[model samples]
Target chain A: MYCVETDHLTYRFARNEPVVRNVHLQVPQGSIYGFLGQNGAGKTTTLRLILGLLKKQQGIITIFGKSFEEHRLQILREIGSLIESPSLYGHLTAVENLTIYQKIHQAPKNRIQEVLELVGLSGTGKKKAGQFSLGMKQRLGLAIALINKPSLLILDEPTNGLDPNGIIEMRELLKQLQREQGITILISSHLLAEIEKLVTHVGIINQGQLIFQGTLPELMSRREQSAGIVLNTSDSQRTMGVLEQLHLGGAVESSGVVLPFVQKEIVANIARELVRSDIAIYGIQQRTDDLETIFMNAIK
Target chain B: MHLLNIFQSEWLKRRRSLASWLVVIGGLFTPVIIFTMRMVYHQRLSLPQKFQLPDFWQVSWNQSWESMALFMLPMGIIMATGLMTQLEYKNNAWKQLHTTPQRMATIFCMKLLIILIMLVQVFVVFNAGLYLFGILPSLLLSSVSYPAADLPVAMIMQWNINFFLDCLPIVGLQYALGLHFKNFLVPFGAGFLLWIVSMSGLTWEYNYILPYSYTMLDYLVLAGRKIRIGTDIHVMSVMYFAVFIVGGYAVYIWKNEKG
Candidate 1:
């Protein structure tokens, strides 16, 4: 069953322009769903709608098979979120901050230290949060979200403003949580490459519309249908003419020819034809599976 | 356990701040200044009335609680108001607290109770300071003059309790103003405006509604019977504490927007 489902979720601010226009999403249980979009593309808005932070003007948001607004508190108990930048009280220490959250959740003190250690924030309990670096603050925010042992963790641009090492650490931590605890994660990122590395399933959204939603393999399969083999040669003009003689409308670049075909046999035939025509093909390459290709294909 | 956990964490957050320490120390200064000023006044008056009366001025340990009204209580209220408003303005503290499973009412009460404890500490120390200063002198002067009247001392003590009760509304109003205004200046300015309006005795009846007005009322009641005639302190305080706390909290919940 889908851990989270939004059926035609629509939201409009008071200005009345539709920010999120009938977006649909289905995140299966134990799936690491990467929500991808550019800035102001309503990724965060959709997450907020699911969390019941913002009311949906027109749609239904079901988390764990329950409506968000009706069971907001109970739903929130099951799902933890790190919305926007980690907004926290600056005056409190790391431990103090965690303690406040634990008190609210009625979690045990042992779990507080355990989460602190898990986030690599142990023994820094005395340091004020205001003094923490951005990376440390982000890690601490993750710790707060993890303290309740939530079944689902929603992170919005979790790696924003982080160093390369910080990003890697965050990615590893998220994967670790999923593996160890079976926690479903819905992480939003504008960078497709980053999500491609960590996410098993992805939902590409553009202009408030969910363009694609499926497993990585399924997305790869879609690209496989439109897959092209690029043939590199010194005489690009001759190669173009030769391909045109073959009645193939392939893309001609400065150094190579891009032949679009679904079948692997078609690529072999094209390669043989090139060799038979005495076309010195330097290289024959098939398109590698990448989110950018799927994203461009979906949006285009 | 939940409230205690919340309070301990909240207290740890503030325990290290410079401003919080200043408030703790500044609270002590209010009573000290008032009591010392009274000591000089008493000395001067004693000199003038020395020939006619031997015991014209007598310093008593019981008068220390009275000194708190002249400075400490109002200052404590102002400090608390500033702290609460600063918490809102400086950070997204309210939103942070609001999102917790703890209800809004619980958070509000937690803050209020903490501030009350801090203020209570200030009062206790201020009273202690006055006692140290006044007790020795009162005892020293007892032999020189006729024995001090215990009745006046007991009456002053009773009036001081009523006086503290009367000041509750002032603290409540300050709390309400702090919560109403998101900006620090408005709450601090309101505290000062309350001070100015309360000190000007032109409209005693209406001005008495102000929390700071109780200081003047405390003075008047202690001075003579004219002020206490028909003014039941107990009933007035009960109404203020109930109405102001409930009213302030209600306004907070009504006006406060959840992020």
Candidate 2:
């Protein structure tokens, strides 16, 4: 069974503008689902809807085969989350902050030390959370998310504002949590490259719509289908004009004009047309195999 | 979670917060001022021919209530509750708190109760400071003598209970305002404005209509300003508290954006 499931989830901030539209998400058990979207692309809004942070306007959200409305507390008891930035009391020490959540979850006292050690924060004694570095604060947030020993962990932009080292540490910690504790994690990020190495499944959102959701390999394999022919021309504007006249769909890029791979005769004809128009041709290449580039293009 | 666990969680959160300090400072401010003034003027009250609990307790109570009931009590509740409520928002912890296993009702009630408890702590400290103000005069000044009648424990306890009741609506009002606004000044400003409006109506025939006026009105009645109105300020305070507290919770539960 899927660990987290949603059906026809739709939400809008204003009446005319929908922030999330008809998103059906399935996060499998024991998998790191990468929720990818650019800023304001509704990734956070979708996660919030699932976590009951925002009221569900039109959707069915279920975790562990239980509806959120029927068993919200029970489902929430089995889940842990860190939305956007870390939410912490700056005045309290690391242990103290974790202790508050421990008491709230009624978790065992020893779990505090265990999770702290898991997050490499056991030595951060007597230091207030406000005094810790940004990376340290992120770890403490993860520790709080783990205090309940939850089976399903939901993190939105968990690695935001982290250095490369912090990102790698978070990736390793999340992997360890899944391998050791058998936890299912659904993590969101705006950049596919950041979570490419860690996620087993990927979901890409853009303009409040789920454009893609599949396994990482499945998403990566999409590069084969999106490969395009690149044209380096002197007068790019005239080249685009000729292509548009010929009903060729092309997008302007910094390197050159890129269009879907076409036959060699068609390319020669285009080159001839460009020459007739007094446009210099520098190079021609057919390549778009970079999955990051493909998805990043799709998201944009 | 059990009530004790929730209480412990809240207690630990405010360890180094402004609300905690407000309780301490707000409680002891009036008494410290009284103590300093007594020492400066070398004031001494002679033992009257007939000295009872009134002579000993009334002097301290009335003197303390002059400022407490008029300004400090209402304004202090406004500020303290604002600080306490803003603690979650200031640290961006409301989303964290909502994601927990606990129910929203439980959190709402426990958080509000914690603010009320903080107010009671202020009352307790202020009461204790009054006793200090009473005793320190005799110790610091050579001529002043200890009152012949002992401290009226039951009377002062009753007095505190009454004052606390009078302050409840203010607590409820500020608590509601604080929960609604993320900025601390919104509630403080609203409370201050309402208190001013409430004070201006003290002479009007329908002055008892305003909840903010209850604290000062109770004091006015105690100081022999007969209102001749049939309405009981204590009952009205309780009623207004119920309205604000319940209305606040209802809005909280019904609203979409919790965190």
Candidate 3:
């Protein structure tokens, strides 16, 4: 069953354009769903709507096999989230902060120590959360989210403002939550590289609309639809002419004849012709697509 | 049980906050001055005046309640409610709190309950401070004799209850403003503005109409200043408090964006 689902979710400010338009999210259970979007792309809005922080204007949100509207408290009890900034009281210490949530959630007092240790904030005794570094604060937020041992976790830009080491640490922690604790996480970030390392599923939102949603492999497979096959041979001009004669148009650049890549069979055919034409084949290379390129193309 | 949990959480949020300081400071402000001034002018007060009955407890209670009811009670209520209600917004934790498993109504009521409890705490401290002012002077000055009469427990408690009742409407109004606005200054500013209005209308015939004026009017009526409504002011104070507190809750619950 999907851990969280939204159907035709649409929200707009009064007398303004839609901030979140027609978003249908299907986050599978036990998967790290990366919610990718640029700043103000409604990623936060969508998360808020699903958490019932923002009243639904037009949509249906279901969490843990129950309707969010009808069973908001029940759904919320099993979910944990940190939207926008890390919502923390600067005056309280790390344990004090988590204790507040613990009492409210009625979780065991020991869970506070467990989450603090899990977040590597065990040594931060009596230091107010306001004095914490940005990375520390982010971890503290994660600790609070895990205080109740939630089944589903939603985090907005969890790796934001973190150094490389902090990012990796956070990524590993999220992976541990999903793998060891069997928690489902939906983490939103503008950095695909950040999310790419940990997300099992992916959703891309642009201009307040969800443009792409699928598994990581499904997103990776989209690259095959367009790639350039470069053939470097002893006689590049001859290879281009022969390719043009074959009606498989090719452009001859300084590298060689660049052919439009379609499939393995097409590449095999080109190699077979190159050998028949007596052109000494030096190398054949296909340009790979990066995630940024895929993300940009998806938005377009 | 959940209410207690929320209450504990709410109190934790207030730890080391200015609202907590305001309670202690506001509660002690008048009594401290009363104690200090009496100690400084001990020679002059050695001879009791015509108003001094056998028991000086009444005098001490009057002096304590005089400034408190006229100014500090309402102002303290305004400031405390404003500070307590704006805790989430100030910390940027409203969204975090809103996402918790608790219902919105429960959150609203628990926060209100915390603020009200703080108000009670301030009264507790102030009452202690007044008692100190009452008994401490007899020990220091040789000319001043300890009162022959026992501490008028019933009268003191009655006055405490009445004064608390008088200040409820201010709490309600300020709490409403506190919920509606994110800035502490908005509620603080609006409260001060209403306070000025209440002060100006002190001698007016219909001063009772203003909920903010109840504290002062109750004080004035007790101090022998004639006002139109000599009836019980607690009822009026309570009625206004009910309206404002319920109105604040409705505004809070019905809000589209809780954070």
Candidate 4:
């Protein structure tokens, strides 16, 4: 069974404007699903809906083989989440903040220290959380989510405000958690480059709609097919007219006219056709396929 | 089991809050102020030879209860409720708490329960201070011309319990306001303004309708006579208590589920 599944899920904060439109999501069990979107792309809203933090406006949400509405508390007990920013008590110390959740979840006292050390906050002794730096607060939030030993963890931009080293540490820590505990994680990020290395599956969202949802290899294949040739011509408008006459299709870009790299012969044919048309050719180069390019294209 | 865990968590969250300190100071304020006023009055004016000092114990109890009902209880309840709810909103902790396995109803009830417990502590401390500082000091002044009656332990206990019951509606009102509004100033300002309005409510014809007036109406000091409690006032106090408690809990649960 999928760790999380939502069918025709939709949400709108105001009238006539849905923040999360009709969308279907599938997260395979034990896989790190990277939810990719730009800022204000309904990433956080979707996570909140999945975690039952926000009331689902329309559609079905199923987690661990049961309906979320029918078994909300049971599903929530197995899921841990950190949405937007860390929700912490600034007046309390790191350990104290964790202790409150520990008592609520009925976890043992020792679990607080264990999660603290796991999040690399073992040294924040007696310092109020308000005094903590942004990175430390993020760790503390992660630690709270981990304190319950949930099977599924949903984090919305968990590495949002971290420095380079802090970002790397968070990436490694998430990877380690999935490996060691076999936990299924649904982590959202606006930057594909940031989470590409950690996600086994990817779902892309744009303007409240699911643009792409598939395995990493499936996404990579799309990128492979997207590889094209960039040709710089003296008369971009005239070259476009000539290419249309020859049944060739391409788009004008700042670098040049870009056409699909269907075959090596096509590149030669285009070069010869442009020469015969007397359209001055400046340069020709092949563009490589990567996740970043695929993500940009998919969103666009 | 989950309910107990929630209660325990709520308690721990409030262990170091400013509301607890405010409650402590609020509880002691009335008695200490009354005691100092009596001391200064005795020091300043010499009485006529035939005039006997008013019943000192009665005077102390009346002043303390009046001060408590008029200012201390309203302000304390407002500040305490605001402070407790502020901790949740300060860092958006309400969102975090809602994501847990615990039900929102349970969480809301547990928080309200904690506030009630804190108010109870304030009540107990206020009474304790009244007896310790207000009554004991008067007895020690051998040269004073007041009547020497043994401390009316039963009367004092009755007054404390009555005032506590009378203040329940305010507790409910403040808790509802605090949870409904995230900003501290809204609830605090509302409570302050309501307290001022409640002062006029005591003399109004429909005083029973106002929750804030319940404390003043329940016990009264008329023309320097000993404080009196009427049967109608007791009945009205119970009704106000029941209405506000039930109303507040309904508002809390409705808002939680609707969100």
Best by DockQ: 2
- lDDT by residue for model 2 (A1-300), tens: 899999989999857789998999999999999998878889999998888889888989988988998999899889999998888999999999999999988999999999999989999889999998888888899999999999999999899778999899899989988999899999999877789999999888888988888999988777656778899999788899999888898988897999987899999898898888888999989875554566565665
The list of candidate 3 runs beyond 4 A from truth reads A224-292, B47-55
Interface RMSD of 2: 0.8
Report the lDDT of model 3 for residue A127. 98
- Give every collision pair in model 1: B170-B211
DockQ of each: 0.25, 0.73, 0.66, 0.50
lDDT of 4 at B218: 55
Which portions of model 2 miss their true places by more than 4 Å? A235-255, A259-300, B43-54
TM-score (chain B only), all candidates: 0.73, 0.92, 0.93, 0.81
lDDT of 3 by residue, B1-259 (tens): 9888889999888899988998899889988898798888876766334124565777677777788988888888888888787778877888889889888888888888888889899899998987776667777766666666678889888877888898889989898899999988999999999999988987777777778888788777666676776456789889999999899999888889878
Kindly report which residue pairs in candidate 3 clash with one another.
Answer: none
- Backbone collision tally, model 3: 0
What is the lDDT, from 0 to 100, of the residue A126 in candidate 1? 72
- TM-score-sorted candidate list, best first: 2, 3, 4, 1
Interface RMSD values for all candidates: 3.2, 0.8, 0.8, 2.3
Deviation in Å, model 1, residue B76 alpha carbon: 3.6
Q: What TM-score does structure 4 among the candidates reach?
A: 0.87
TM-score (all chains, Cα) for each model = 0.74, 0.90, 0.89, 0.87
